[model samples]
Target: MMTDTTQSRGRVEIDDVVIRFKGKQGTVTALERTSHVLEPGTFTSLIGPSGCGKSTLMNAIAGFVTPAEGALRLDGKPITGPSPEVGVIFQQYALFPWFTALNNVRFGLKQFGLSKREEIDRARAALDEVGLAAHADKYPQQLSGGMKQRVAIARTFAVEPKVLLMDEPFGALDAQTRLVMHDLLLGIWRKHKATVLFVTHDVDEALLLSDHVQVMSQAPGRLIRHYHLTQERPRALSRSGNELLEIRDEILGLLHPKTMLADTL
Candidate 1:
């Protein structure tokens, strides 16, 4: 597709952000003074145990959640709320079942006040980029799980958002499909070069996909560990061997120390 690479401008700053929620029982601290800088056009992944606040932190970046303390900024401006500049993709392919793939993507462009022709053209190009141009007329029910996710991705990228926030997008797919999605995602990512913050529970997935992986500690999540991947890109799942395995084990141990200990025993 014909993405305007110049539109990409994602740079994020999380400064000592602390998120707390007042529940019926008590105030639960979801995140505690967690901070990280997401460089523009870089891919960052967040990984940790179930209750660890990875998703909470991602929501804060997406402007869906407010921090109890500190701040969040994109390119030096405070994030007040959700904007077209930041796009979010969740695990569920939230495409409209009634709409065709092309129209679904076009729906997102309507907010930009594009002409009818412009919207159609852009949407078509986005679907083309994801290798789904031929399926433009198909509805969600006509597509497979992976195809639906691609349409979802195409919809997000169609707007050319500066930042992309993803929550377990591939978690629903089978292992084979997940690997294929991984490659497809990386290809689209390199073309767009938007700042990406991806949240996942899979350590190997984090290692395979991100430029840097931030591991949050158990509940009341903190930035417990950071892994910077040195391997070159265009990496395949099969190519992820020794170094990635070692890092995966290290992250696994961090996320599941008690389990690792029991296994060693």
Candidate 2:
């Protein structure tokens, strides 16, 4: 979805990643030998059951969590820790309560050392891209849940991170709002050209928004399958073609126990 110039912004390589956590039950393997490469500026989604380490892998990419054994590289450089070039958007709005939407979005730009005017200009442009320019003066408490998420989105893209890691960003929205956010996300993604790795449990959402959907198995997660979607952008579930439905069914068969049972019957 990226233009030629910004196409080089996002390129990621995950090599033989293994993640583990310490629990009362002992060491828990969250992910095992999982690896993948995301091409520059591609929109990819990770879909799987809860606790299957989809978020764990995302956190690893965001530099929030370290892989017990593996490597993560962005643009051919090893990712040692969180950097301005990588941005994250969680399911929670995570907006500062005291800050206006405009200020919240502008906060990340301070790291760039832009003068007061330049920071405001970039932040305004980001808000405009997400259709929230008019609401810029509103605080998070004054905005709806959907609007709050839009501001979060505006904040992430304002700094133009090379890679955007989204952890179920629209999971908290209602059905109608989720659909609206899908379109909004695609528009901004195309415009910014940041390599996007979206994590979602919703099969339709994954297929609708991604160029490729990677499916992970239950706990001790591994890359079970990956589907490359052929549908054009601005996609809607109702208007999806038969091919899309077929792929959806196939992914469903892998993720849903009942569907998997029926497949063998």
Every model's TM-score = 0.92, 0.93
Cα lDDT tens digits for candidate 1, 1-265: 5544443367788998999999999999999997789988899999989988889998998999999999998877799999989999989988999999999999899998988999899999999999999999999999999999999999999998889999999999999999888899999999998899999998778888899999889998999888888788766546855787777778888888878544652
Cα deviation at 143, candidate 1, in Å, is 1.9
lDDT of 2 by residue, 152-225 (tens): 99999988899999999999999999999999999889988889999999999998999999999988898999
Error of 2 at 242 (Å): 1.0
- Cα lDDT listed for each candidate: 0.89, 0.90
Our tally of clashes for model 2 stands at: 0
lDDT at residue 169 of model 2 (Cα atoms): 94
What is the RMSD of candidate 1? Answer: 3.8
